[model samples]
Target: MTQSEFVNLVMPFKDKLYRLAKRLLVSTEEAEDATQEVLMKLWDKKKGIGSYRNVEAFAMTMTKNFCLDRLKSKQSGNLKLVHSNYADDRTSLQKEVELNDSLEWVGRIMEGLPEQQKLVLQLRDVEQYDYDEISEMLDMKPTAVRVALSRARKAVREQLIKKHSYGIQ
Candidate 1:
């Protein structure tokens, strides 16, 4: 692929790649580096990239693997899993505070979930990937993806409810 073609193909989902990296790595700088590295890898392989059936899925899988590997590395001892993607400009100050608190709680709850469930939740809920795409990226069956997403959502919901309902009696 020519440089323009490669740019056209990859630019659209580059933010998605960064978002996934940030979700896994919990550091903006690390996520930016990871996205750049993945983009560079794709550019280097641009000659044969057209042969792939779904380049976006391939790129997402690459980003996921790269971030996971980084997390497992010795230098990742200080890295923590936290997400902060909620933003709404129209809400009142109090509403925004409440929303931030709720999202923080959800992030903390997600941190306690299994790695698979966290990935499933991030892909399906945060990134808005479909079941088939998530299945391909994560190497899971579509049904399995659905089940994991369901369970992850249920777990987050239950925990949030429990947290809010505490001391209500």
Candidate 2:
């Protein structure tokens, strides 16, 4: 593919790619570097880009792998995932505070999850990717993706309940 064609194909999903990286790396600078690296890799293989049936999915997979590798590297020692995607300005002050607290708990809970569960939750709940797409991106069977998402959600719910229940397990 030519430069312009490559740009056109990738521009549509570039932000999603960056968001995924950011979700995993939890640092804007690292996410930017990861996004750039993924783009460079795609560009390097532009000659075969047309062979991919879903270029976006392929790109997403690349982003996911690249970010995971970074997370596993020694350089990521100081990094930690912290997401704050909830917002509701129109609510009462008390409601807003409660919402913030709930979101904080959610983020902490997510951080404690296993990597597979966390990635499955992030892709399915945050990114709104369907089971098939998540399975394809994560290289899991569709049923396995569903099971992981279910278990992740259940784990989060159980943790929240335990916290709210005053140390009861």
Error of 2 at 66 (Å): 1.1
> How many clashes in candidate 2?
0
Q: For residue 122, give model 2's deviation from the true position in Å.
A: 1.4
Model 2 lDDT per residue over 77-161, tens place: 6533222222233223454335447677688677668778888888989989988889899989999999999999999999788
Candidate 1's C-alpha runs over 4 A off are 75-100, 167-169
Model 1, 61-113: lDDT tens digits are 99999988987872456433223232232223455345556667677677667
What residue runs in model 2 are displaced by over 4 Å at the alpha carbon? 75-100, 166-169
Q: Cα lDDT of all candidates, in order?
A: 0.82, 0.81
Quote the positional error of residue 92 for candidate 2 in Å: 29
